[model samples]
Target: MGCSHLVIQRDFAAFFLHFFYQSWMLYPENESTIVSWIWIGIGILFLTTAFIILLVTHYFEQIRKNKRKMIQLVRNAETECWESIHYLQERDRERLSEELHDNIISQLNIIRLNINTRNGKELNSDLKRSMQLVRELSHNLTPPDLNGIELSDFISDYLVQISKEVEVLYVNHTEQDILISGTIKLNLFRIVQELITNILKHAFATEITVLLRVSVKYLSLVVKDNGRGFPMEKYNKGIGMKNIQSRSRKINAVYKFKTKPEKGTRCIVFLTLNNTKI
Candidate 1:
């Protein structure tokens, strides 16, 4: 009986040990599955973070590229402006030479001939005309006084003088007084003179309209004619057009030209007054 009891007790102890071993193996399998899921979650989070960083970096790169392009464009425009100014100066020198040779020198030669021929009667008249011509030319070259006179008054006087030949209509659309720098005023005067001269020389227009608009922020000048317009492609190649462009750049103003065949020509110059010398 004692031996049988001892064997039964040993069997029961073995059965308990086997059950505990099986439980330990089952627990390890379940823990391994949980660990694998946690590892996958960590990998997905890392990938998502990397993607967001890449997107942000790409956006900033695009912004930097655009900024560089804008800076380059501004530099190019400034260089072109300086080149235009140089060309204009050269053209003016040529004009001065021509004026001296054709007008002043020619007139002096005639006077010398008259004196050599002993034509005293006509000499006085010729001398007076030549002096008057010289005075007129000098006045046109010199800059006008803007201290006492307003810009509108100066332009009005100019228009009155030119009104005799062509029907000119002047319109000033500003309630308050307009003020501008002497340099700006002079350039503006020259631009207007050039435009009118161009119209007289080329445009067979019956009437011309000059409009001046002023505001707190900007000033605009519009010159339009009712005549046959020339081709824009050809006209842009002319010296007069180049002169206009150079003057506009000198003033740091915006220039626009509108024209079509038989539709007449319109030139508009816009100047911003904010933080500008004008």
Candidate 2:
């Protein structure tokens, strides 16, 4: 074993000795080519570093431009949002004024007339009617208490009131009181209210059907009416329609209207509560 180990060491030493000798013989011949190749490599390294620096500069510059663009977009969006809020406020005030003038004030004027004519019975009836009108107006203004009831029940209750005037159907495909955030539910309720109001006022239809469907990912509310339909493009210009649009936006919902001249109208709103973006 010792003799074989010695033989292996001798073989390695001889091999290295021959290698150095051959390199020493070749060095002078290859010296200029080797030096030229080294300089070329150094130049390549410098060029690569300069190219990398340029690329990094351009990348950072692009990032800055994108950031500026994003900030400007945000500013524009904030201005638009404020404008929308003011417009909606003004519209709501106008609507309330119109309702007061058209309903209770007119009724009071009639009561005053009855009193002047010395008609006690008619005055009493007019007073009662005015009281009922006031009650209805107050009810419309006050937001419903949603802490105890589910969103479906609140909508269903509204449909029941509307059913007295029009044929109404309410269908819930999910649990009656499914777990949902209060803000999300409130926005949804407002959307439903707006849709029903629009349908009652504009759709001279005989029947209306409301469907609420919930899934793991999202929920959809659909209102369909069998009334004379108006073009959605034109109707969307109205204040009521704008209100619905705004509410849909708040809840990150998508709404579409389907209607023809004589055909009934179907309004669908889809909302995604699970999205953190909302």
Candidate 3:
């Protein structure tokens, strides 16, 4: 009877151990519900990621379109500014030329004729001298040299004459002679003349230097002054600067500046030049 009891006890112990092992390995409490929730969370994360990527791509496209629009607006504005400035300068030069030639010169000749007709005792020597000076001044104001001489030589001589009134130092660095068409030379000469006038009137500079250099690729000009320089941010958008910019563009050149208060100013221009002439 004691042996039979021992066998029954062993069988009961083995049955309980197998039941615990199966419960731990095959099934946890509420496993089906937990797995369904995990799959839903993963699907939400994937959708959020895709949406973010789409939004970023759309933002980049908008930025590129805005950049292109901005560039186009700038180009249009520049072109309009050029047209307006060119028109005004041409009109001004034409009117001034006419006034000098037709009105002032005619008046001077009339006075000279009257003096000649009056003859002897009525006219004083001082009066005749004054009339002569007037004629000379008029001629100087409307110089006839623009149409005749080569522009490079003309500019050199012109600068030399201006130097008597204000100090000017210049260098010419082109290897071969430059012979520009009349229209281009006239426009360039007027631009240079304006710059010189400004330097004399406002720069208050003791020294001024101009350099003209040419290479196969480009022709370059530099004008520098040791004087009080203006703020480019304020001055470059002004009417005078606009005029200069238009003229430079007409010549297919680039203009830039370097300046500082109490230090000095430098103006630079670069233009395409043929290899044969440089």
Name the top TM-score candidate. Answer: 1
lDDT of 1 by residue, 106-161 (tens): 45554663465546666787688678757856765443357776677777876764
The C-alpha stretches of model 3 lying farther than 4 A from their native spots are: 1-148, 275-278
Greater TM-score among 1 and 2 belongs to 1
Q: What tens-digit string does per-residue lDDT give for candidate 3 at 22-103? A: 6546767756654664466456545655655666677788899999999999999999999999998987775465434333
Model 2 worst lDDT run, 10 consecutive residues: 98-107
Ranking by lDDT: 2, 1, 3
Q: Candidate 2: global Cα-lDDT?
A: 0.71
Q: TM-score, each model?
A: 0.51, 0.50, 0.48
lDDT (10s digit) by residue, model 2, range 1-278: 33454565466556655755575577867767666755665575566556656766787899999999999999999999999999999878855654554345545644553465546775686689789878977777543356776778777865664565678889998634356776677777767666666666677788999999976568999999998899877887876676677667767889998998778999999976563322
Model 2 clashing residue pairs (backbone)? none
Candidate 3 TM-score over all chains jointly: 0.48
Candidate 1 residue pairs that clash: none
Off by over 4 Å in 1: 1-142, 275-278
After superposition on all C-alphas, the RMSD of every candidate to the true structure, in Å, is 17.3, 14.4, 19.6
How much is the lDDT of residue 178 in candidate 1?
55
C-alpha lDDT of all candidate models, in order: 0.71, 0.71, 0.64
Q: Evaluate residue 56 in candidate 3 and report its C-alpha lDDT on the 0 to 100 scale.
A: 69
